[model samples]
Target: MVQARIGERLGLAPATVSEGVKRLVTEGYVEIRGARDVELTEKGHLIAEALVRRHRLAERMLTDILGMAWHLCHEQAEDWEKVMTPEVEEAILAKLEGEPTCPHGNPIPGTSSGIPWSSLEPVAALDAGAGGVLTRLLEDVELDHDVLKFLEEHGLMPGSHLTVMDTAPDGTILLEVQRAGTNPARVALGRNLADNLWVLPAL
Candidate 1:
């Protein structure tokens, strides 16, 4: 992913995000080949994929079985992802009708199954009407408060359709996003919020 794009999605100040990426490089989780793009190494991919699986399953379990609100699911999933074991994850998947994606519709990476993580564009880059289901949220330790609030309020939770509607000189964006279902409501999102939303283009 591009540094600026990652920063925007994580709602992180550019420098802090850069430092974290640097540490990831030092730790061998990421490889920086040039000024613009970075890719995960094999070990990095393994860890990232595992986290992805945990995240999606947690979202599904929280929303579907536990009667949790969708906006609240991310934080809950974040905590659960840390303690989730492989066996537990498999059980959740089985209970959820073997669904491949989470409540917001982001695909869950399989632990023993093989599916590659695609490099995706952040919401900050797209023009109005450009849309895709959110597959992941970039993790930046110093993410902004406003961005997180916007995400929760607007249903830009993972698996939601993210459409870019505006962009500003300072890198702020305006977006239209919605959940999947008949007559799903569309909401506007500001740049701080948009920057933290990540997505793969729809097929």
Candidate 2:
């Protein structure tokens, strides 16, 4: 992403983002191309994977064990991940009991998750009458608590089934959401919201 956008998301100033990027470049963790395209190097990718793994694990613990709301787990996990030692991480993994995904259905980097990412597509791309199982949400979805809460209210949690019932010209999608132990719900989703929700289409 561009440095300005990165800083915007991180709530950091331009100078701070530039300095951080410079340090990462110096350490060979990332490289810049074009006018301001910063991309992660192989070394940086590995480190980022590890961090995401830990963060996902923490999110699982918060939502499953601590009973925190799924919408709030991601940001809360940020603080929890910092203090977690290797041993603690292992213990938490053991407690998760072969579950490879967090509350949002995002796979932990080193786990044996069988999710077929290549076959997944956003619900927004499906037309009326298309059906699929909601699989995972994008990382950016976690950045907005309001979006998460709205999804939860509509029963859009992972593993729920979604069917596109109709579409409006204004880019609003009408979806029928089905989850275990509840009646199917008809929810209206904006294009931007549905774009971030990936699904596994039925065969």
Looking at model 1, report the run of 10 residues with the lowest lDDT sum.
110-119
List runs of model 2 lying over 4 Å from the truth. Answer: none
What lDDT is obtained when candidate 2 is compared to the true structure?
Answer: 0.90
CA lDDT scores, all candidates in order: 0.71, 0.90
Tens-digit lDDT track for model 2 on 1-203?
Answer: 89999998999999999999999999999999999999999999998887888898899889878888888998999998777777878988888777569788888878877487899989999989998999999887889989889989889989899999999999999999999999999999999989999999988
Please give, for residues 1-203, the per-residue lDDT of candidate 1 as tens digits.
99998888867999998899999999999999878698999999999989878987997899888988765677678889989999998788888764456654456675333123556766766776687877666544114445556666667676677776666676666666677773455565555556655687765
User: Model 1: what TM-score?
Assistant: 0.56
Candidate 1 wrongly placed segments (more than 4 Å): 111-203
The residue-level lDDT of candidate 2 at 21 comes to 100
In the order shown, the candidates' Cα RMSDs to the true structure are 6.8, 1.6
Q: In lDDT terms, how accurate is model 1?
A: 0.71
Clashes of each: 5, 0
